[model samples]
Target: MVFDVVCIGHLAKDRIVRGSEEYEAPGGACYYGSFVLRALGLRVAVVTRLAREDLPLFEELDSIGVSLFPVQVPETSGIENIHPDPDSDRRICRPRGFAGGFRAEDLPPGIEARLFYLGPIMPGEVPLDFLRHVASLGPVALDVQGILRRLRDGELVIAPREDQGEYLKLATYLKADDVEAKALSGVSSLEDAAPLIAAQGPREVVLTHREGVLVLADGEFHRFPFKPRSLAGRTGRGDTCFSAYLGRRLLGDPPREAARFAAALTTLKLERPGPFRGSLEEVTRLLASP
Candidate 1:
C-alpha cells in the first residue's frame, strides 16, 4: 500500500522524573510523529520494534488510522529522563532497555511511501546500510538525535557521529535541535549550523530551538517562533515540529509557510503532553493570528 510517510524507529517506554513527580509515557519519533502526520490528514505507517508485552501500546496508533508494522523483540527499548530543573532543558538520560537492531526483513514488503522518516531512539537501532536502503526507496527525512546520542557506561551521551557526513548524504530532509546541531557541526548558531549541515547533502535542514523553529531550504532561511502557553509537553517538541513541517511540505507549502505552520502546530503541542491532539483548524487559527 502507498502511504504519505513511513516512520522507522524503536518504540520507547520513557520514564520522566521531575523532582517529586514521575510518570511513564510512550515515546520515540515514530510514536509522536505518526500522530502529527495523521492529524494533518496524511496517510502514515510505522515500522518499529518493542517487547511483545508492549504490543498493546500500539493501540493508540491504530486508533489514529496509522498502519503499523511491528516486530516483537525480547526487550522494549526505554530511557529514564531525570530532570533536576523543570524549566531547563538539561536532563540525565539512562538506558532502561534496548530492543535490538533492525534487519531488512523488519520492513514490510510492497509498502510504498512518498517520504521515509528515520527516527531511531538510540545508536545501533539503525545502521548505515539500512539507511542507504531506505533512501533508495524515496525521499528521506531523518532526525539525527538517535544517531548522535549513544549509551555510555549507563548514561546517554550526546556527541558528534564519526560518520555523520556519510549518513547526512543519504537524507533528503534533516531534523536537528539546537543542541544536536551544535554537537554535530561545532557551531552554536542555528543559522550557521543549518547551512553547514545542509552542505553535506540534505536539501533542507530543520533546526528546533527553545524559542523557535528554523528551516534552511534551497539556500534560503525561514524561521518562526513557538508561542506555547506553557512547557507542559516539551518532550517531543522536535519530533512534532519536524513532522508538522514535512506534513505541510508534502501538501505543497513553501519553506516559509511550512515553517510557520510547524511552529504554530508545535506551540499547541507544547501545551499538552503526548502526541499532538489539536486540529488543523486550530493550527490555521494560530497562524492567522498576529
Candidate 2:
C-alpha cells in the first residue's frame, strides 16, 4: 500500500521523572510523529520494534487510522528521563531497555511511500544500510538523534558520529535539536548549523531550539517561535515540529508557511503532555492570532 509517510523507529516505553513524581508513557519520534502526521490528515504507516507484550501500546495509533508494521523483538526500548528541576528544561536521560535493531527484512514487502521518516531512539536501532535501502525507495526525513546518541556506562550521551556525513547525505530532509546540531556540526548556533548540516547532503534542515524551530530550505532560512503557555509536553517538541513541517510541505505549503504552522502546532502540543491532539483549525486560529 502507498502512504504519505513510512516512519521507522523503536517504540519507547519512557519513564519520565519530575522530582519525586514519575510516570511511564509510550514515546519515540515515531510515536509522536505519526500522531502529528495523522492529525494533519496525512496517510501514515509506522514500522516499529518493541516487545510482544508492548504491542498494545500501538493501539492508540491504530485507533487514529495509522497503519502499523510492528516487529516484535526481545525487549522494548526505553529511557528514564529525570528532570532535576520542575522549572528548567534540563533533564538527564538514562538507558532503560533496548528493543534491538532494524534490518531490511523487517520492512513489509511491496510497501511504498512518498517519504520515509527514520527516527531511531538509540544507536544501531536503524543501521546505515537500512537507511540506504529506505532512501532508495523515496525521500527520507531523518531525525539524527538516534544516530548520534550512545549508551555510555548507563547514561545516554549525545556525541558526533564519525560516519555522520554518510548518513546525512542520504537524507532528503534532516531534523536535529539544538544539542544534536551542535554535536554534529560543532557550531553553537542553529542558524549557522543548519546550512552547514544541509551542505552535507540534505536539501533541507530543520533545527529545534528551546525558543523556536528553524528551517533552512533552498538556501534561505525560515523561523517560527513557540509560544506555549507551558512546557508540560516538551518531551516530543522536536518530533512534533519536524512531522508537522513535513506534513505541511507535503501538502504544498512553502517552507515559511510550513514552519509557521508547525511552530503553532508544536506550541499547542507543548501545552499538553502527549502527542498533538489539536485540530488543524486550531492551528489555523493560532496562526491568525497575534
Candidate 3:
C-alpha cells in the first residue's frame, strides 16, 4: 500500500541514562520519525525489523496510526550508550547487524510516496543503487548523521565523508545539527554551514544550532529562534526536528512556517526526557503564537 510518508531503518531497544534508573524505549530514526508524523496527523508507515521478543512495541505502534512495512529478522536489536550533558551529549550506537536492511527487490510491488525518508543504519547501509531508485521514486529527505557517525571506543564519532557525497544529492532536504553541519560542510559557523551543505546536495538544508535553527531554501535563508530548553537527559532531538519539518511541509505549510513549527516541536521534545515522550498537544502549544 502506498503511504503518505515511509521511514525505513533499524529499530532497537535503547537504554538511556539521565536521572535515576536507566530507561528503555524503541529507538531509531524510523521509530521516532513515524511516531512524530503520526502525531502530526499524517498517514505514516515504518519498515523495520524487531526481534521476536520485541514484537510488542511494533504492535503498539500499529494500534496507534502507523502502518507497518514489516521485515522479519531473527537477530534485530540496537544498543545505545548515552551520556547526556548540558552542552555535549555522547551516544555510542551499535546496530547488531541483525537487520540487514530492506533490499530494493523487497520493496512493495509498486508502492510510491510523495516523500521517502532513509536513515541509514551505517555508512552505505542503504546502498547507492537503492538510494538512486528511492530518489527516482519521489522527493527524498535524509538524515545524513548515520552515514558519517561511527562508534569510537563506544562513543559516537564522525568520520569524514569519503565516498557518500553522491547520495547527498539524491536528497531533497538535508537535516543535521551544527556539529554534523560542520562535518558535512567543513565550515565552522552555522551561518557558513548553510550554503556549504546546500551546495553539497539537496534543494534545501536545515542546520539546528544549539541557540536556534536555520533553513536555507529557494535561494533564501531563514531562522527560527527558540528559548533553548535544558534537555540534559535525552537524545534524538535532531531526528525529531527533521520529522516535524517534513510533517508540516507535507501538510501544506510553507517552508518558513514548517521550520517555525519544527523549531517549536523540537523545543517541546527537549523539555521531555526521552525520544518520543512529547505529545501532540505540547508541540501544538509551543507552535501557538507566543
Candidates in order, TM-scores: namely 0.97, 0.98, 0.89
RMSD of every prediction: 1.0, 0.9, 2.4
Give the TM-score comparing model 3 with the true structure, all chains together.
Answer: 0.89
| CA shift of 224, model 2, Å | 0.8
Error of 1 at 200 (Å): 0.3
> What is the number of residue pairs that collide in model 1?
0
Clashing pairs in model 1?
A: none
**Model 3 clash pairs?**
none
Candidate 1 TM-score over all chains jointly: 0.97
Q: Whose lDDT is greatest here?
A: 2
Error of 2 at 219 (Å): 0.6
Model 3: per-residue Cα lDDT at residue 13: 72
Better of 1 and 3 by lDDT: 1
Which stretches of model 3 miss by more than 4 angstroms?
Answer: 84-98, 226-229, 275-281
Task: Provide the clash count, candidate 3.
Answer: 0
Q: For model 2, how does the per-residue alpha-carbon lDDT over 121-210 read when each residue is reduced to its tens digit?
A: 888888889899888999999999899998888889899988999999999999999999998899998888998899899999999988
**Which pairs of residues collide in model 2?**
none
Which model is ahead, 2 or 3, in terms of TM-score? 2
